[model samples]
Target chain A: MAQRTLLNQLIEALRCLPGVGPKSAQRIAFHLLERDREGGSRLARVMAEAMTRIGRCRRCRTLSEHELCGLCANPNRDPGLLCVVEQPSEIVAIEQATDYRGQYFVLGGRLSPLDGIGPEDLGLGLLEERLREGLVSEVILAISPTVEGSVTAQYIAECAAQGNVKVTRIAHGVPLGGELEYVDGGTLALAFTGRRAL
Target chain B: MAQRTLLNQLIEALRCLPGVGPKSAQRIAFHLLERDREGGSRLARVMAEAMTRIGRCRRCRTLSEHELCGLCANPNRDPGLLCVVEQPSEIVAIEQATDYRGQYFVLGGRLSPLDGIGPEDLGLGLLEERLREGLVSEVILAISPTVEGSVTAQYIAECAAQGNVKVTRIAHGVPLGGELEYVDGGTLALAFTGRRAL
Candidate 1:
């Protein structure tokens, strides 16, 4: 029998996503056909629209359909307390936690000199410009706890110090609601280092 | 931040395939945007086109872009030997093996009384009508080895017996290239029952 050419093409297109492989792509394509017609059309429309309309926010470099993203546009959010994150998904994770009530600056990616990713690649120049505006008082570096994340945090910390802004990295170690037995040795050490007295 | 409404919708819709979940759907939406614009458009075009154009073949009930599917239209194929299967994917798998030379009749689903699926639901009437045409000399039941597959096979066997047509079932149990030590007890038992002496 002849293959569904269009279906195969769509499946191939989906393989370019971060973690998707060919099999997953095929599954997704079939799922779209079997389940969500409206949803599939909406996805196509959104991709086309987002590609044309979404741009980097001028102030924070976060993805936005407008000149500024909602966080940057809001007046009530603390402009003095800015949380810096590496990717858009990280912003969503932090938002879900609902512990921070501050504006955000999305770096898009971290500095990885080995991979040729640098400060400019992550829009660090714009971050420095934002810090120089004199409205920000505290900067929270909420990047991943990887080695590259630590290096990026240090570089951003130095830049914040130069601008006379108080800079702090988010605490590392065991996750909330995690059992001690499940916590790894490296995380246990980090937890010990970040301990606070009652 | 305001949701990328259309993008989110598309992601949600694409999650309907058999094994797809939400995260994979999001990754797929992003992949389509970043790469494969041509392929993506082709998928969209084909989806819309297929929804408008493709239908079940009048003779065999297989998915067809035209009035008859490729298998049904080809004169070289044996019209006297008909292989019956449960789904389209099974046809693909059998085709990949390149051992089966006859055309197929897709039942769309099996007879599952517990699920309210019966002979009528599986289009047994059409099958009976096709058998009466006298063009079919033998009917091969190629359903899965599942309980439902067995029930469906029995039902079809009874239907073929009434027409005085020769009926046969594709072998069950141990797959080709399967090692006996690795085979499960249930499958091994079935293999022993269906065993052939070399």
Candidate 2:
């Protein structure tokens, strides 16, 4: 057996990236070695630091280098309005696309009993404690409309109700720029059922 | 102004990868942090070492940590048949898909005078010296059929002619398993002109 070179090792390691297959990994490796050595070096340094240093924010459970994420630490953000999401990336998506000025709670994933993801796994007990603290006026569900997501949202809504906090969900329907014909049946039905007087 | 977190910095740095835009960078960062920290750390360490240590092979100009690339150092490879390619990745492609056992020379790129690339820049002088040493009996051009590729191939063929060595090129045509209707015009024309006795 021929010894694998450093070039081969770099290519193999690059396969760890999501969506990068064998061909793409090889291409990325050669591209870095040939044209972007500086970029590759910087990526290595930053990636190493991020892998070791980043931990979940104690308050919101979002990825952060410190105890609290920047959003959780910000006094300007509304503590009275808590938005719940399934993943940290969803927080980024909401932040980029919307003007919502509220605090967030990351569930990490939807509740699935077969997968053993209980309320404790999602830190729901901590969320209930925050709700019981009495600062929160409203709890918003930005979770997906899947069965597991619905169960998770329902469970959280009940927890908020016990604390006498109002609960609402972000509207789900045909997206803003979507054509009605192209929208899926479930979304179109939701759009019709949720329609208000015009 | 809010301070950028290490997570954001990691996302930004990840964009340096070819074909990875903002969304993909964000996805990869989150994926590594959430699911594959071990793979991410290994990638970082290997990537750093490869970037800092790997250099061009003295003989073939292919990427290597040692002075000579593995293929160049291998005693089993035929020194009499020199196969020239435009990039180091092309060498890997040929090695995987073909059974031809011969020496390889990576030109790094074809002669693009508009981009200030010349013969010396491609290590063509070293190639010429090797041909003149009387050991190599055949020189094979596996370069692309672009205008610059043709010019480079023609120049190398002339160098071999001057040394009284046999020169050949890899055939270009509709690829194996390609449909005739989908094959492009230039390639179809080449296929017709290069048709062999069957």
Candidate 3:
């Protein structure tokens, strides 16, 4: 056990990350102190500020320092199309990989009823309210291809259908540059079924 | 480009860690904001406190909030046996793995000559002065087994010899619990050469 000092406290604090343990926490702490004290100081200051200021965007549920996030606040992004994702991390992945000029709606989580995550827990009512605005002509479901994700997509689709908006789930198949031999059986099956003429 | 905000600033700051890029930094920032805001705040507060207070222990060159580190100041540890390591991180690793009751001397870094790190750069003078004190009976070189590490170990051995102190480098062989089939060639050679008696 490390002595209860501020140094040890700093290391212990870093272990709250998903994969980081004591070794990595200590490494990161020492690295920050040795290499980038200014960055360490700024991280501390900004973390405190972000904790107090950042919250869910009122409209899309993405993290924001204000009522609305940058993606939701921009008028240039197409409001006629809305991409629904499980978390804010997926939004960043989509933005980097594709030229998606449409808006997004972060579900915050998926439908895992066994885990007590129901439609109500994921704010389906708010999603339906956004769909009823009539600005969105299409809603794209970009949830992961898990059982809970499928259920979430289905629920969101039904909600969107009520507003007469087309609901389309993102295609699941053999990924680009992925070898069929290495692709999972379920994905290969989907690719075979969704085959189209070149 | 992210908009300049406290959230963005925090994400940017987290990127200072080794192997952490923009994506991981953003993910860590969001993770903190959503699930562990309290932990994040604590990390921030601890980081600031540690940075402001923690400095090198004058005797051992390890991190300490005061003149001497806990290990150095403690009466229980053997002052006659000194463990020399390249970094503070290594000291933690050695302490956890072995019940070595010796005090430590952090070299901070090895002799990286290509990077222009000379003998003086590593504060070898301070180390020789410690050796000259005559209390140390043995100096254990726990530096890495790299080319530069070997050179640094050799140089320290010469310095310890001057004070009539026995200098020994930590053995390099297949790590404990590591399989022979999975082990690298250089390690296999070292293991064979340094084969222990049953």
Candidate 4:
């Protein structure tokens, strides 16, 4: 191990990022110190600011610098349609690929009895309150299509129906550009069951 | 686009790392804000400290928090055999792979005339001065095996000879665990030419 304490601490801290391991962390730490000091300094300042100032949006539970996130505050987006996701990152993925112009609700986590995460933990109470307002006509469940995810979605659908709102879920099938041979049986079955008239 | 200015700026700054593009940067930024605020804060502080305090070692030109790096300051390591490398990262690679206990000289970059790098830019004068001290009996070139790397190694070898010091280079061939079928022709040729008797 290198005898530099502070440098080692920096490397260890970088490993906390998703997919970053010891080797990648070391490379990033060295690159910042040796070649990209200005960029590193900027990253430091922005990260500090984002960490201290950013918080969950009151409406969606997504991390943002304000009480209401940009998507929640934008009037151009459809208030009649709401998309629900398990994590804030999922919101970005949908936004990048889809033309969905609706508001979002971040569940933050899915129902998992093993993990002790239930509707209350996901702030489903807040979701029910918003649905009861009668402004939203449809609720789209965009959570992952896992077993726990299905349970969570079903529970949410029941909650949405109580408010007289139509409930739907995002489709699960063989991914675009994927070969049928490599697609899992469960996904193929879902694709067959959800086939649309062409 | 996420319209939170501070969050977006954090993502942009994270893209400065090697192998990190827009998507990875965004994921990292979101992960920090959403899941690991304590880790993110510590990362920011360490990055600021490293950016401000770390500098090139006065003796070896490697990154360090002091005038002399750990290797340079150690009294027990052999100063008679010096290893030369392109960057500070290479020092780590060599240290991890080999038990070579010797001093080092960091060229910081390879010789590439098209890239406007020359002997002066590489601090060849400093290397020459060290060799002229006459304590060193051998200088090992650990530069990469590329055209520019070869040119740089040859120039350093010539410079080392002026001080009556023996110059050698690390062997380049099929890697220890590489399959012969997958080895490239240029490397296979070098392997064939450099074969040794049992």
Candidate that scores best on lDDT:
2
Candidate 4, position B91, lDDT: 87
Against the true structure, whose TM-score is highest?
2
Output the better candidate (2/3) by DockQ: 2
A best-first ranking of the candidates according to their TM-score comes to: 2, 4, 3, 1
For candidate 2, lDDT tens digit of each residue in A54-117?
9999999999999988999999999999999999999989998899999999999999999999
User: Among these predicted structures, which one has the highest DockQ?
Assistant: 2
lDDT tens digits by residue: candidate 3, B17-106:
777999789889888988999988888788888878889889999888878888998899999999999888888888888999999999
Docking class of 1: acceptable
Cα lDDT tens digits for candidate 4, B26-136? 988888887799999988888888889888888888888888888888887899999999998888889888999999999989899999999988988889998998888
lDDT scores in order: 0.76, 0.94, 0.87, 0.89
Tens digits of per-residue lDDT for model 1 on B31-88?
Answer: 5644555555555655555444545677777656567787888888898899998765
How would you encode candidate 3's per-residue C-alpha lDDT over A39-121 as one tens digit per residue? 88877888888888888889998888878888888889999999999888888789989998999998889999789988777
Q: Which parts of model 3 have CA positions greater than 4 angstroms off?
A: A192-198, B111-116, B144-162, B172-198
Question: Which candidate do you rate higher for lDDT, 3 or 4?
Answer: 4
lDDT of 3 at B72: 90
Which runs in model 2 stand beyond 4 Å of their true positions? A1-3, B1-3
lDDT of 2 at B109: 94
Q: Which window of ten consecutive residues has the lowest lDDT sum in model 3 chain A?
A: A1-10
How does the DockQ of candidate 1 come out?
A: 0.34
